[model samples]
Target: MTETALSFELPANLAVEKFIAKLSKKTVIELALQQYSLKTFYDSFDWRLYNANLICEFNQSKNGSSLSLISSLNGKVITSTELDDVPAFASEFKDNVMANKLAMLLEVRALLPLTTVDLQIYKINILNREQKTVARLMIEQYDQLKTRLSIQAIKGYDKAYIRLSALLQDEFSLKTAEKGLLIRALKRQGRKPNDYSSKLNLKLTPEMTAAEAVRVIYKTLLKTIKLNEQGTIEDIDSEFLHDFRVAVRKTRSALSQIKAIFPDEHNAYYKEYFAWLGTITGLTRDMDVYLLSFDDYKASLPESMREDLNPLHEFLLFKQAHAQKELANHLKSKKYLTTLHDWELYLKRFIEKEDLQKNTHISIKELADSRIWKVYQQVLNDGAAINEDSPAELLHDLRKTCKKLRYLMEFFQSLYPPEKIKTLIKALKGFQEVLGNFQDYEVQEISLKQFSEEMMQQGTPSNTFLAMGVLVQGLEERRGKARHDFTGRFNDFKVPLNQKVFKFLFAHKSKGE
Candidate 1:
């Protein structure tokens, strides 16, 4: 492959004022290149100096004790995170950015883990017009590229953070597919390849791993039961259900994440474990998201104008109950337990192997990032469609894929800066929430409308039918408003998205070469 000269300089004395100056002047890239980082993609931070047409990073140092911000002109302030804490910072940025009310200081001087300095910078134009500035860019000193980025050298504990932190933090890096890492461990243990381990890398984790996938099935079943309530259970809003179902999907992802690297035949439960859960949850989860947005659709309209709303609501509610029931029975079945036991046995076996010692130094986060992007590209290539027949349903499915991507990104977050990770996560979450809200209202509207009509047909008291009808109409109004809100958000993100996330994931960079 061919290469080009792009500069990325780091702060030898790194200070806030100088850092601010570096950002304001757009010199961070040169600084980044000085250390030779090979980061191919960047965030809004990379654009701080000047939105370069293209960004390439090279110099990569191992993980550090404190946070490292690379102004390396890759175009974003990529924070090197050793700690997995970013949502809190991301939330702060979101709040601050949305407020748009500049704090007396927009610079990072006040931020933690870094100090202030002489913040000044100059612009460099070497693109477009015979080599000219196409736009009056922000006059800043952020270097697009930066110092080398590397891992495995940090003075950490005995094992990979995965197992080491387990005893300390009571948290285990969530796993989806365990086979890949296991393969790596086996190699370290000098295991020879056999029919048992061949072609394991090509395997796909079923819709849900048998062991962990049940979390989703059970959650979906609970949602179904809550919705069924026969008027007895108090179900939370669809948003709550939406969250639960999504979490369940992640558990499925965890199963897949941990297994993608291992050989399948040796793993008895590999093929059968996730298939059943995936089928049931796939259908129920789709409906759950749609039902949540159903009410939002009705709510969008004015109280006086929802003639079509009544029937739409009725049809959806009736249909959803069926989906919910399927989920409930799948969870209640003894088959689920049988699958879980098998899966557990496999994990226990894999973990106890002599090969397990090799994985002690392994980091699953790295493995996850590479595979996650491959998965995203695969879906993007095969193509997914969203339309009226089941727009909400299709969208929820899309979000599940998005969740896997999100989780993978989160795991290897130290590979990038907290800010960069947060920004991407925030944008993706925004997209999900917009569609998510719309789907929520749509579902509620569907259920209540059907309930009222049924009561009316049965010659029930006017109070029961009228009360439910009023609720349905109220829901339609909410739906109309939600529709507007969802559309507005969805449209606003159309252009910003291509630059923001699509490129972020697809960009290929050698491991901090």
Candidate 2:
């Protein structure tokens, strides 16, 4: 079904019947026109878009005020291609779809016109029939990045609402759904399986448990996307970069929350992915934050400084673009495809079919840790296997390991004292920072070189490019120093790691301050 949600009311000046008649027939529409009293906590008609899943919404009252939020259709929970056509439809109905009825309180039969068909995942309950063909929202387990987390307690809608809300919290199940898409991605890419995801699913073939399936789905991200750091998009077109940033943010958020749900032993795998995603996404994100904090930082500057700022922006943009391309390449690789496919197969196998019903209460850490650690050790070995020409790939793998460790510690941190875990966390943070700085600088340097060349070719002014060169020089030097320091610090890790410091910290962690 199309993932678009459109809700519009007729203007008070205009006839409600006329507006409803005009807008009721979408390319494929299902209508629920019913009066909804505002929740007591929200006395006003505070209607917000549910999630990123919202395509476009426009409302008009008989009065002359309206509201609308533009949307996109990436990773929409509802699998409908019609959603791709929503923007055009929105563009078509822009004028009459919204009402100018400006009332803080709206208490008519609020129409909810949706464009989707797959309603099996949704079960609506019939409270007193309000003549609305649509069932009252019994369950809502959806969240868009823009959507606020909320709880609604209707007198009779509690069961479905609670069930769906609970299901949404179990991300393991969501990831399994995503894993299906990943499988499609893999077949689209032409790759074979690594046997990890499928094997795990096979073990769970008896009956399906959304809870149990979650663990396996998480393991896939730990194995696949966690290997590379995120890519930035500042250097691209503004619109492209904006969407790119959003995608990166969502992916990182997904990775973080998914890892957070697993038992302690399995936590290591997620930690590594989180670490890597943070490292890669940091440079451009820092720039974005800087821009957000000091809007005039780049535009208001002395001549020399302006020159430097121009180049710096150029350099950062280049790095961002390069990072995105790198990530894209990584995602398209055989290794990634294998992981993605295997993950989906497992999801379909385990989640769709409940296997472990009898002994479902055991901690999954034992299973996750033993399995992931074995793979992680092999990753360390595989990284070492790369020749000098492939130092980058090797380094990527190393960062992956660190990410796994970070994921592990973070998940298990609940079991340990903050103080005990502090030292180890600090070190992990440092290691991630060092490599991150190096990567950003490398990208910056390359971009500067490109800008300088392009300027020479175009015979543009030199001051900005020259200033950028100077900036890169400073960053490059710092990066060199950081790398050297990181190597030394990497060696330093031997001390605590030898004593099983992380494990010890986790084992003895305090529950409270």
Per-candidate clashes come to: 131, 41
Per-prediction TM-score, please? 0.37, 0.36
lDDT of 2 by residue, 1-513 (tens): 122221111123443344224323411223333322111000111122222223323222232222343333342332111211122122232334222221111222122232211111122322333542222322211111111122223444545444434443452122112222222323444632232221112133213332563444454444433322231221322222333333333335434533333344434543454455455545555444333323244444445566455544555556555665665565456755564465446545644454444324434434333333443344336534544345554556566666666555443343345676667667666766655666766765675577578666755556766565666676678667765665565555545463376444322332221
In TM-score terms, candidate 1 sits at: 0.37
> What C-alpha lDDT values do all the predictions have?
0.41, 0.40
Worst window of 10 by summed lDDT in candidate 1: 195-204
Candidate 1 has an lDDT of 0.41
Candidate 1 segments whose C-alpha is farther than 4 A from its true place: 1-247, 254-259, 263-334, 351-366, 374-397, 411-415, 453-459, 473-487, 491-506, 510-513
> lDDT tens string, model 1, 283-370?
5555554555555555655555444455545555666677776666766578865665565555555544523232222344334445
